[model samples]
Target: GKDGSPLLCGSIPGLVPKQLRFCRNYIEIMPSVAEGVKLGIQECQHQFRGRRWNCTTIDDSLAIFGPVLDKATRESAFVHAIASAGVAFAVTRSCAEGTSTICGCDSHHKGPPGEGWKWGGCSEDADFGVLVSREFADARENRPDARSAMNKHNNEAGRTTILDHMHLKCKCHGLSGSCEVKTCWWAQPDFRAIGDFLKDKYDSASEMVVEKHRESRGWVETLRAKYSLFKPPTERDLVYYENSPNFCEPNPETGSFGTRDRTCNVTSHGIDGCDLLCCGRGHNTRTEKRKEKCHCIFHWCCYVSCQECIRIYDVHTCK
Candidate 1:
């Protein structure tokens, strides 16, 4: 039980000193924090699987992403956002499930009820989740630099993604499922929904400039959009300060592994296509034979039979 105890927060990987302190204070929520990080990383990989970067992680270091997040690129912004959102989402879910003593379902609905529906059921305590996530995740960032400011903004954007997607769920109560009265409660959208929304924001991420302000407490760094033609990014949008490297070839400087053996679509004109993914270096095509079950027949005696078939397809990879 000692190894499995939540109080062993110091054993958790990828946690900074401040985060370790936070974990010890909120021991019960440590599992959810770990779950949130896993969720965020998984979603990052899923969202960028076909792209050049592909959200690769290094197993050698507790930093997890190696030097990939050291730069304030759009890729880093997306990672920060998704990771922060994962923590909030997981904590909120745990609260709704009554797994913690400090928090529970949200009972802070304001205003009058809707026409026919009244508030009922458990609304997830998203505020508590977001607050805890901020306290824990932002603790690691103690620097007063442009990259830190960018990361903080992107992190909030990710958590805001969860809040923005919250919807009202209602249950009908009446005779034979008739709509005599309805009870509605706020519910969180699926994590995939948050990932998809953030992916869109990543595509349209705003480029920003560092503004240094002289105050009583030394110079403070802030971010402002480089382009002012459109509306500035709100709390729900991602922001980046630097341009990303072309990850077609292995670059130790940028922490890019490249796409040497990565599969590419021969016909697609998008980022996943051979042309873009290979960085105009051309691709190698190979014929692969795959075995599958074919010509299946259902027998009248509750048995089914199928014939084995060999299928050949052309596979393309970056040169």
Candidate 2:
């Protein structure tokens, strides 16, 4: 499964081949692209684990992803950002490892020099990753409509986050006990960092507007004037064109699968908590018991002994 080869986008049922060709030069990293999409889905499900609409999948394997992305809700913005960031991270790493030839270590501005370190290691090329991601992911957003504009902008925002989070990592040497001299290199931040940053953006996502600019003679989408009270959004901000549904009941049209029978935290007062998740239908609680290794005693050497312990806890689920 780790084999590196040319991936034909059209071979996948739900994948959009038309826009994929925009990144034809990156065909060698096609496996990375598919992995990125899966990573995005996983991240989405993780982020929404406690919420009502918990990122469920459709009948087709990855086929529903493109259409699900077309919606202009806050969820859609998060999906686009996470998915695009996944691609950027994957391709950049592949480039650093010599698996892909279209890109290499970005020797651009290394970290600050006063830190007593010299840049040396081959860092992943986030610049190349972002460029390739924009070409492929944004290609599907061809319409001049607001939804398309929002998608393109959110996709770019995701790629930009990868570049913004690239940091300098270093190793010290040359002296017996001091870091007087060191070798540092730019490294892409971990996926969790990207996921956390994108989650924060998702929490504050703004509902936006798409309109024709008479002077510019093209379509433009931006945060509505009402949403601009604090400040106008920079290019990096995530913007959406529609408000999300309540997501309390199964609405096939809106993509909500409802929260009935979903597990919840009894102590939580927020979305994942029993109150909100059950939508006031109230929840059922049952006692669950399990056995686990416990009451352990440390041995003089490398081994420890333990006795089985029975644990009982209350499990809560929507009625």
Candidate 3:
């Protein structure tokens, strides 16, 4: 019978009904058997998906085998092992070939003697490849383009390095130097880890400013309280106390008391002139008048008066 379903066994031409019962039973069980094989294939695909490998190659292999292995045999353990091995082999081969092509290495050559026996140099290049593979797996699981995801990772790494270098150099200390312009590279996703580091530095600076202001305020308060008690003097007091007349007591025996009538001849303006000479009284008050002469008072009391007056006036004038 040329039915639409695929033939599992050799075609049997024109057989009787009872003769074909055994064959029919086997045919009846084929869907269940195929279901088991499908389960095994699905498990293998899951395991491969979990492994880190190139996205393009994995997708291509899955697309090719998806329909062909839909009706595969599940009765034999050997077939299951072979299928799993096949999947693993395809993934590993794709990774190895891609690495060799990028690094200009011959994939056919055996790598150095080791347990894993890989062909790559197993240094920086291998590590980079491993990182790429892990990122590729992530992209696959997330249903994104692996190449674009890898590019994003590389760009972030580069930006992070630049931000870290800038942060290190920008000490902002007066002893060192400050960054002429402030930057918030810490807010970027790539530099998020160093955000805490920058925040600690910023907090430290803020604390210092607050402490300095507190100390300055304390010093000003102390000065204000100390100088609050003294009062200053006025300018009028300075002038009056500095210009008063001084007197000494007169001696009566020397004709220095009440001798107002005595006169002396003196030359005044090229002519002879007479002037009166007398000590006015026996008291401490003495007075003498002379023409064209400026009089000044000299006494210890006057000196002290003037000095105190000037000192007090200066404080008030300053304020």
Candidate 4:
């Protein structure tokens, strides 16, 4: 089956040789990788919708991932975690479906402690998904550097978050509508839920040090000593080695394209507000008329109709 199922990511451009090899090894995981990447991009866009970067993606290749990931910034940390989590969620959910030959009910988890429901209603094998995802994602950072360590840890955190959110779902069925039978299974949390969780982690991501130490015993990280005000970083936390730029003006050095020509919410007072989004550059307004369907009415036959309406609105853009 692995032979027949070619990895969807095998065709992806810009992947290094080792990454290609990893995908080939888990061919069935390929589809999950593809789906996961798309979801990751979407989640990034959602999370950064009002920001300068705006989490844009290009279709030609993975270059769209850009130099952002190359740096150990908060943005990169979020990208890694969200991407890994997306893959884990996709693969885990795939396991429970009839079409998935690669995985099925988490044999590891004993079903619901003496369940009254169907013994096993095709639960998602979340552990397997997390493991494979970690292997592939963490492999790239095998180098002996503090950045690599942080990346690996964040990757694991992503998988951990996905696995943590796997919930037990149940369904009820019975003859004559009696409440006698029930079916339960493990279900993957919605990708949005994972995105929201990661967003929270991103907001409070830790900044760490890449210190050099005597290797008498072994090579170990020493972040606690540097950032003593906070507790040691946990598997649940997102970690970064560097600070991010304000991203106000186009700076190729930091991969920021600036906010020029970008839309702004003139009336808001948050980050999306014109003052902030324009970066003290101010904004220009233009009025336009748009048409939309309105005054819809539902019919007895489950069909509805609507009439066209026109409205005018002001548009604001960064100078």
Candidates 2 and 3: which is better by lDDT?
2
10 residues in a row with least lDDT, candidate 2: 1-10
Of the candidates numbered 1 and 4, which has the greater lDDT value? 1
For candidate 1, report its TM-score: 0.90
On residues 218-251, what C-alpha lDDT tens digit does candidate 4 reach at each position? 7755443248888877889998988787888876
The TM-score of predicted model 3 comes to: 0.15
| Candidate numbers, best lDDT first, in rank order | 1, 4, 2, 3
TM-score of each: 0.90, 0.88, 0.15, 0.89
Query: Model 4 residue 98 lDDT?
Result: 49
For 231-307, candidate 3 gives per-residue lDDT tens digits of: 32111010001111111122322211222222222332211122212122211222453343224446766542222
CA lDDT, candidate 1, residue 263: 92
Question: Arrange candidates by TM-score, highest first: which order?
Answer: 1, 4, 2, 3
Write out the backbone clash pairs for model 4. none
Pull out the clashing pairs in model 1. none
lDDT of 4 at 155: 86
State which candidate has the highest TM-score: 1
* Best-performing candidate as measured by lDDT: 1
Off by over 4 Å in 2: 1-7, 14-24, 59-70, 174-178, 213-228
Residue 9 of model 2, lDDT score: 50
The superposed Cα distance between candidate 3 and the true structure at residue 240, in angstroms, equals 99
